[model samples]
Each structure stands twice: as structure tokens, then as C-alpha cells.
Target: MVSEPSDAAVPGATVARLPYYLRALRDLAAQGVTTTSSSELAERSGVSSAQLRKDLSYLGSFGTRGVGYDVESLASYITVALGLETEHRLAIVGIGNLGHALANYSGYEARGFQVAALLDASPEVVGTRVAGHVVEHVDDLAAVISRDDVSMVVLATPAHVAQDVADRVVGAGVREILNFAPLALQVPDDVVVRSVDVGGELQILAFHAAARAAAL
Candidate 1:
């Protein structure tokens, strides 16, 4: 019974937290739970009940007054909102240790990302087989992308050269990019880039530990 927004403007924080809610709802469904109260879902998603209610309001009112939300229906709605309805063809560029590990991960398949190709600049590594797909050379990127119809790419190249590789991918018509290199990338407004800053996360964890020690 959630109302659809005419413009569908979902806040960034709400969008990011949606996956947590979806995971919690799926867990509830697995346990034979059909309905859940807002407080229960909020606790599972690590958010306040009021915050969860506000976040869900963006997608219309799908909750009941006393019985709460339908687990299956809520999970389905979040899945659709997060665009997990279709499989996205993807490529992993750089083929370094991190890239190699990511290429072998089976989790991406479950999340709707299909790793169609793996690319690298090293001739010694190129043509090597990893995770059932042949590692193609970066020079052959356009051809590989064309052959596989890759819609997104993960950049695992060195931080210094990640932007150059990004430029190449953008030139080849890749609009969605996930960057694992420890640097920011510049791309045209038409293209979207999401970066994983591992160092920053570690620093935040260190800061929290320092704060705790200082309080002690």
C-alpha cells in the first residue's frame, strides 16, 4: 500500500540503508516471520524506529498500524528500489591481487552482478584463466566489452593510473564504475563512479578506538 513518488526522489542515506533493511527482512522471512513491528526492523537495521519510518515513507506507506510491515512485500519493494531485478554485466580491470580476489568472488552473482570479463595490461597475466573467465588484455578492452556487453566495470588498477583507466572505460561507453583504487576519479557528469575507500574506514575505526581509550 506504499505510494509511489511522482519524482521518486530517494535520499542518499536512505538509499544506502535500504540494503540493511532488505537483509533484515530476508532474515525474518527465513525464520517464518510474516510481519514485523517498526521497532524490530529498526533494531535489525541498526537504526531508530522513527528514522526507519521516515526512510520508508519515501516509498509510500506499506506498513500496518498495529501489525507492522509484511516481510516478503517489504523485501521485494527494497529489491526493486535497489535495481536488483536484472543482472548487470560487469568487468574487473587491472587483474591485480585485489582484482583477482574480487573476480573469484561468488557473492557478486548473488547480488545481480555478472562478471563478464577480466582485463589487465600485463602480457604475462593476460590470457591467464581465473574464475573460469580468461583474463583479457586492457588493449583488448573495447572488444571484450563489445563481445560481453558489459554495463559496469570495477577498477582495481594502481591509484596513480586509475583515472587514466577510467578515461579509457568511459571512452568505451561504460557509464557505471566501481573504483577500488585508493584515489578519487574524475569522470563526465553522464558517468557515475562509486569508490571504496578502505584506508578511510580503517582510519575511522582507529579514531573510535582512540576515543574509547581516551575516555578510559
Candidate 2:
């Protein structure tokens, strides 16, 4: 595995595409494919070969002239580049439907994330178990976060409570967040927040589908 240079600065767009390349490399490895050309890797990742090459260039050269890249090596390099080399513990607040699903997701471990704690404001949910974790009261969020060594938080609460929960999480010293709430959150400049708006995504897909039908 190639060590990413500490001083090398990768762009946000390139950082986003790193996961796709890693997934494609893992898929190739699972198929007993030991090596892959940029074209083949790009095809698997749904990006053009040229685009893939450009993105990979930010991580420094690795592929051979005629031989191509070793799948495992490339995957490992991307893993380190994306900061997935170590496991990140996550605390999912709000034991509602969305929160429960996120806690139960098996894919997190494969991507170097572990659901370390679950919290909810509701008294009924506080003592209940979801995904093998006893839901703690949000009142003790700071303690739970520190105790579990939670490095990231997933906010799946309602729009009204999401910001309040986010504030609490940030106050607890967690810098990374994945927000599934519909509304935008106001976080400090140092904190990184990635929002997943399911409704907005579907609306975009619907617009594309309608445009395709209209052209036909």
C-alpha cells in the first residue's frame, strides 16, 4: 500500500470519487481479478477512463505502463486516502425509523464505521434496544459520545430537533456528521457535515426521467 503524502492536498471532488474507485477495486478483487486497467476500473465505477485517471493522479502515480494497477494495492491506497484505514465509531441520535435503519446497516463495518451508540429523546426509546445497542437518552449524549469514543454522529431526528441534536453533538467534540434530516444545519466551519436528502435525490431522478420521456 502506498502512503499518502501528508502535505498532498486532494480536492473535494477527487475525494468524493475515491470511494467509487475503492468499491470498484474491491469488486474486482472479489471476482479473483488481481489487476485492472484504468478503463476497466473506470467502467466499473461509472466514470470515463480519462476522468478516473485524472482523479487518481492526485494520489500520485501507481499503475504500470503495460501491466495496469494491482487491485488490492489500489484499494488499500484509496482506503488510506479516504481516512478509512482506521475504524470510526458513530453515535446515531433519534431511534426513529430512519435512525433504526442506519444502526442496522451492515455495510458500515465494511466501510470502516461502527455504530457505537444510539440515543433518542423519547422516554420509550431510551431504554429500548435497537441493533443490539441499548438506546441511551439524548440527555446523556455528551457522556455517551465520550465513553464510546464516537468520532462521528448521524443525525436522523426530525427537522425541528435535528439542529439542537447537532449542536449537542458538536459541543461533545465530534467533528464529522452525516445528517439525514431534511433541513440544513448551521455548524461551525471546522465541523464537516454531509447531508443526505432522500426526497431531494428522488426529485432529481424524477426530473431526469421526465426529460428522457419528453425527448422520446
Best by lDDT: 2
What lDDT score belongs to each candidate, Candidate 1 first? Answer: 0.90, 0.91
The 10-residue segment of model 1 with minimum total lDDT is: 1-10
On residues 1-216, what C-alpha lDDT tens digit does candidate 1 reach at each position?
556643679898898899899989989999999999999999999999999998998877778787789999888888898889988999999888998899989888767789999999888999899999899889888888889999999999999889888998999999999999998898999998989988999999999999999999
Per-model TM-score, in order, reads: 0.93, 0.95
Off by over 4 Å in 2: 1-8
| Displacement of the residue 101 alpha carbon in candidate 1, Å | 1.5
Clash pairs detected, candidate 2: none
Top TM-score prediction, candidate number: 2
The clash count for each model shown is: 1, 0
